[model samples]
Target: MTAVVQAEGLTKYYGRRRGLEDLTLDIQPGEIFGYLGPNGAGKTTTIRLLLDVIRPTRGRVQVLGGDPRDPAVRARIGYLPGELALEGHERARDYLRFLGRVRGGVPASRIEELAERFEADLSVQMGKLSKGNKQKVGLIQAFMHEPEFLILDEPTGGLDPLVQHEFLAMLREVRRSGRTVLMSSHVLAEVESVSDRVGIVRGGRLVAVENVAALREKAVRRMELHFDAPVPAADFEGLAGVRDVRVEGAGVRCTIDGRPDALIKAAARHTVVHMVSAEPDLEEIFLTYYSDEEQHSARQESA
Candidate 1:
């Protein structure tokens, strides 16, 4: 199947500053792909290129099997921009109504349905709405069309916890219908929960793409154990998939990658008084890229 979104050597620049640099990626149809990065890492720039809001400086982009600039192709896609801007004096409902009409006379019922689903109060003025409410309006507009492909950037930026959870459930519903979603977020836990696969971008380049399950497999689970007495050093030695062991008085800590069975078995051999294990840090993969970049820059400066 053709990818929902495809780009080759995608690049963007704002005069002297590089917004994106020679990025290439593909998002499979019906997959919820998460795009993750920190501020100014070109997440928004990539989204704009996909939506044809701005042309790339080099390389090609295809969305929904056609050029992103084609009006017919855009109709089949829904996009929520990273920065949402609405002028003063317009009620939220009226604004969504205008968008609905622009998108080929979409039914008002769809708009109302989304408003209720998001728990958005549409009577409020656009300028007066709180940041969270404004974000809700943006989300409603994006989902109201019910397009085949949905691309959302920093979608939960201003949402409260409760609303954020509701939004995630709606995304799951979207996926259940076999539609595609590309969600860009910096929040690891949120993205990890909903995404089938994730692409980590740093310094305007794609670093890694992995399925959620595979990522978890490589994740390092931290465990700390307190024994009634100091355990023998040989007891924990040669444990499979365990590393970075540090043992203090009556306590031991280690990072276990892959399965935790070996580590658990090793700990069980001792007189265990207390034990704690933390879920793997999903963001560690992204941090690896940052660290590599820093080291490379340091080498260049030293030279």
Candidate 2:
């Protein structure tokens, strides 16, 4: 299947500063592709390039199999920018109506339905709405048209937890309807909940892309085991996937990668009294990629 969005050697620069560097990626149709990065990690830069809001300094990008500059292409896409700009005095209903007309008349029923779902008050003027309410309005506009593709940047910003939950449910429905979504966020848990595949970016570079499940599999866990008696450190050594093994007076602590079957069995040999395991957050997993890259660079320099 052709990609919904594609970028090859996609680089962007603002004067002498780098915005994004050689980001090569493909987002498939009918999947929620999470673009994960920190605040200045080029997620917005990539989005703007894809939307033709800014031209890339180098490389090429294709959205919906054509140039992003084309009117028809824009019409088929829904975008909710990270920083929304709303006309302060305009009524929310009037604003959505204007956009609907621009998109060739999104049905009134559809607009009403979306508002109801998001619990958005179209009656309020844009300026008077709270940040969370404004976010709801933004979401209603982006989804009311039901375009073939959606590009959302920090979509859940300022949203209450309940509303955020509702939005994620809406995304699942979009997938079920065969539409594609590109969701960029700094929140790891949000992306992990909805994204089929995630692209991790750091320092204006694409660090890694992997299936969400696979990425979770690579997550590190800190494990501590207490034994009835002191256990020898040598007994835990040479266990596959275990690292930083330390034995300290009836207690053992180590970090484990992937499954803990071997570690569990090894611990069972001793009189296991208690165990405490803590799962690291996705950010830690993401940092491993950067760590590996740094190690590689250092090795090259040494060589």
Candidate 3:
């Protein structure tokens, strides 16, 4: 299948500084791709490059099967910028309607439906809306047209927890319709549940890309097991990906990294009355890639 977004050796420079470097990637169709990174880690720069707002120094890029500068391709894309600027005294509803017209017209009911989902009051003037409300307006415009591809940056910012939840659910529905999304955010929890695969970018370089299910296998999870009777620490120790074992009376606590098969089998040897497996530290997993990359880069420079 043809990729929705493809880039080879994608690089961007700002004067003497590097905004992005030697990056190559592909975003598949019918999937939510989470671009994971810290601030200034080239996430926004990559987005801008794809949008053709800033030209790359050297590289090949294709968006929606054609150049991003193609008018037809641009017409098929929906974007919500990281720093959405809403100015003027225009009513939020009016602003969205104008954009809808610019997009060749979107249904009035669609606009209202998005507003209600995000609990946005469209009657208020754009200038008077708070940051969160402005973001809601931005989101509404991005989704109101139902473009073929959606590129969102920090979409959950300034959104309340409930609204964030609603936004994520909406993303799933978008994917369900066989569309594509490239969502960039530092908040892992916000996208973890919806993202099909994630690309880790650090310091302007693409570190790694993995399916969310595969990432789960590699994540560090705090695990605890309760047995009806006491178990031996030796039973859990020395198991692959199992460490920090502490078996006290009927309680067993340990840390598991990567696959938990070893630990699970060990616990199965005993009568596990109860078990508690905390959510994996996905952010830490991403950071490990950053750390390894920095170390390797440093070593290469020294060599």
- Put down candidate 2 lDDT per residue, 192-259, tens digits, no spaces: 88899999888899888989887777788899999999999989999999999999989999999988
The backbone clash count of each candidate, in order, is 0, 0, 0
Per-residue CA lDDT of candidate 3, range 27-65, in tens? 988989999888999999999999989999989899999
Candidate numbers, best TM-score first, in rank order: 3, 1, 2
In model 3, pairs of residues that clash are none
Question: Against the hidden reference, what TM-scores do the models get?
Answer: 0.88, 0.84, 0.93
By TM-score, the better pick of 2 and 3 is 3
**Candidate 2, superposed: residue stretches over 4 Å from native:** 224-239, 242-254, 263-277, 294-303
Query: Residue 3, candidate 2: how far off, in angstroms?
Result: 0.5
User: Which 10 consecutive positions of candidate 2 have the poorest summed lDDT?
Assistant: 279-288
lDDT of 1 by residue, 2-38 (tens): 9998899999998878989988888988899999887
Q: How far is candidate 2 from the true structure (C-alpha RMSD, Å)?
A: 3.1
Rate residue 260 of model 3 by lDDT: 84
